[model samples]
Target: MTAIEQGTAGGTLNATTARLDRLGDAVIVIAYIISVALYLRIMAQYMVGFFIPGGSPIWEPVIACASVALIIAIGIFRGFTGLDRLDRISLAAVLVLTTVLGAVLLIHDGTLVTSSTLRLPPPPPVGTLDALLILGGLVITVQGFETVRFLGDEYDAVTRVRASRVAQLVATSIYIGFVLVATPVMGLGTAAGPDSTLLNITARIAPWLALPLVISAVLSQFSAAIADTAAARGNLTGLSSWFSGPRPYLISGAAAIAIAATIPTLVLVTIASRAFAAYYAVEAVIAFRTTSGVLRKCGFALLAVLLLAITLFAQPAS
Candidate 1:
């Protein structure tokens, strides 16, 4: 019998199964919390040093000011524009940045860095454990592409799917151009360790445009943060009646992030990222709870197992 059918009946086995399901959900929740804590750390170290008392990062204050102004604009405009409208505008900003980046590549003549310097040694054979460990992480580094699922509540599934598809296509085109451009320009080691890769690229190729790129990237990050916050709040609200509103998640999640900020970035991104991947795998299984038909259920069950393997075997992209 299906999960829904079991729920409809008053039977002995069903009650036990429900208890087990709750237990599994509880485990997943714990894993997700741990993963987020690590992710927050990564943001602090590699992404942006959120709290800067004072130093050489003069742009931090500029970005902060611009972010504040943008938030005010969002508040005034959101009711009229709605989330979908705002997302489209933000998406356009990202595309514009990509276009500018591409233009810089065209204008800059000659290779900036040698091909040999950028290349890494080949991995072990595919079936080998080492090869799997090395290769799997490359996939997990791009885990955020599925975040469109979170926006399902605000828009129709068809709309969300279309948006995600368009985003992927555009982003892929931009990324391909960027990789081709940046490969020859940036030395392999320097790009990997960048505090701000966008800023680094602009500085190297187009110094005059650095300020605009900085401001644009900051705004893009702001929009992404807004979307992720909404997703987290939505999930929390669905989790329990006690957390049935926005206020709880807003207050609690904010404080939790504040605490998470204290942790080291390396620890968070490397260790916690794997934990998130594992949770992503389990989430697939949970998604099948409402699915019908034995064959479809079996397929999803196998998919979950496959995801679980990837999650466990995958290494950190860094």
Candidate 2:
């Protein structure tokens, strides 16, 4: 979608199509901003949960506000490249940690037992619509790859395509492998909620792994949020003169902090998913019009309708 928009024949589409494309761009930019904020909120939760266990709810809000302030300040003074090195290092650490987490759980399969401190809850029966809603909500989990589309300035088209493919393959493999390996030990964690399950599971299998896991989680989230914020700013500034300065960053940061203080993480997850769904639905329409093959156009049309449904009906996990 981004490639089509940034193509050489810019705005050559009919005026109505061009208008819709711009509208999609605006939606995408806004959605990315919210996603960055939500990432910071989740990162703040990790910090509080690890460093100040059982801390007051007020602490998450305070930390989130401070984090956004730091992001905005660094963005204004140092630029997005300031954190490039750290982001790379943390991203590598995350990949390594995910590998180790899965391997360790697989190796310790025989020793795993039901949690004594926090019992795993039973799954409730879900109907078809409810299941679809949950699946839609989880679409955000498979994000980040699309961000590669916006990195054309840093990487050539071929490089971006390969990177996107490799990212999806690597991340999806890790997710699937981790899920398969950790199935037996799912009941071993002593978590207060879903967000802290990985940390608790880490502690259960290898006590020594807990601290590094938290550190990696913290760094990865912070760096990802940084990347998203920069992406949002770049897209917004490019789209309109009104967002050409620090206004985009400032406004989005404020909105994120406010949302962090008020909304539950689960709710934020669903909202973020819907926001991105809207963006994708719009992009699907753009693709539908631009492509040549009848079959391909039909596929895009179906995708647009499906994503539109998700945007409207997706629900957070129970």
Candidate 3:
């Protein structure tokens, strides 16, 4: 073929590949949305008992087991998929969620007043458990870069660099903004409350916002689930390629998801939160080890320590 013709053909092939990769990423995003929706629905139904129903007994062990199982399932999946377009969508959702949360706090001006005349109990103390849950959620919310990294081979260098930068900037700004709002609105004391203070704060200030926020939370959770599931499937695909069969990996992925769904929703979320924290910690260590950069290493180390402390110490809402 002529040189010009060859170059044209190559360009077409690159475009085709990029399009396919994007399609696959979209599938993952859809799956994640489904998963999150399921989780939120379940949580909403049981929120009162799970948080603070007057006479209900706590089911900490069951909840914890479910949480661990869900996390393990997601970890296996995310680890398998690495980073991709779905991860980007998931990242965007997180950024948007954080922005809304920050806005809610800003609008409320750090106060926790409700329009209704019902008397509310004081906020809970900042026990280890509360700290862990908040910190863990924040860390996982920003861990989309890892997903991007996994899909690195599929994109050109320029695309990779641009995507990474955009994700980082958005993630950082939202997180910082959220912390600023959270600190004042749900004082450290109130933040430790059994209920999701963030959600409660929003509900109190504007009941209309609650339904939509719940919807968004559900969607975000589902997106995360899709990212996790796709990751698991991709990992299995890699393994199958090495061993010359896709069946094993396919069966494994299906089994994992099935097991996850059977577990209680609250348990799944808690476990997933803690496990993601640990996984991110390890991931940070790996990054540090490979780059040998002191600043990056320290930052990751700190994240790991913070997540671990939260997981081990966060007090369950009674």
Candidate 4:
């Protein structure tokens, strides 16, 4: 969707992101549902393990539920303005942490880099199911960037284009920088855990940075999830007027988060990442099938299959 929106000619179709059909929207909703579930669950766990120490264990549920609920309530009551506030808060945390960490890495560690694969249990033979699943998890790590596409034409065309470019560049740079510094300092083991990556690394190098980074991660995930939840909810309601009311969405959203948070989950990072990859594949297929030209349609269909194939080697999370 982002690729199409950003003027990437997809297959033979002059793909238009603006006129997404119901089916495309529905599949996109599923991708968001699973992605947000994985994000919320991991974030809640991070908070429980780090910030809310020495309290009655009951506090775990409260913290987790409250964090998810608080954002939902904000989204419902405050709408776009509330989301903006959440985005700002999260961004502030990100800016501060990135600046300090980048400076620290350069000064304290000097030039260094390490492969996250260093400490990994030897991955199953390449092309195995385990390897694919692991690679999927790695893909999920950078999935948040696609959320930018949702911003759409909210700004003037040129402004949106420039802004998106700048944002992606900044995001890629920071992520690469952080990984370079963090992998060398903490190794693959620290980041591969179920806990938040920032929380784990900061705990070692900058204890003082831990609290704010965790808060930032939790808030960021919650905010993004709520936004995704609302998108999913809108699609559901659109499917049938019988699914009307904010009540239904609120209940379902909470239930999904709770289930995702408490259950003995699988390789969620892998699951969510592949789900998005699948979502993209589906969109491409839709584009191919809908295109007016037979040649373009076949080209897109082939491209779609190729994209799906590449998921087999996406470089799994460590």
How do all models score by TM-score? Answer: 0.61, 0.88, 0.52, 0.70
Candidate 4 per-residue C-alpha lDDT over 204-284 given as tens digits, one digit per residue, 9 for 90 to 100: 666887777677667666666765666566556655677665653575566666656564334566666666776666667
lDDT of 3 at 87: 47
**Candidate achieving the largest TM-score:** 2
Candidate 4 stretches greater than 4 Å from native? 1-20, 52-62, 111-132, 145-164, 187-200, 237-248, 264-266, 287-303, 306-318
Poorly placed runs, candidate 1 (over 4 Å)? 1-88, 106-141, 188-198, 286-306, 309-318
lDDT (Cα, tens digit) per residue for candidate 1, span 37-106: 4433333322343233222233433333334334334433453235446756776786687577667765
Candidate 2 lDDT by residue in tens digits, 61-176: 77877888888877777666765555677788887776776777777764444323433445559988898889999777777777766665677777878888998898888778
lDDT of each: 0.51, 0.76, 0.48, 0.61
Clashes of each: 0, 0, 25, 5
Query: Which portions of model 3 miss their true places by more than 4 Å?
Result: 1-105, 110-142, 182-197, 242-256, 262-270, 277-285, 292-318
Candidate 2 wrong stretches, greater than 4 Å: 1-11, 110-123, 188-196
State the weakest 10-residue window (summed lDDT) of model 1.
Answer: 49-58
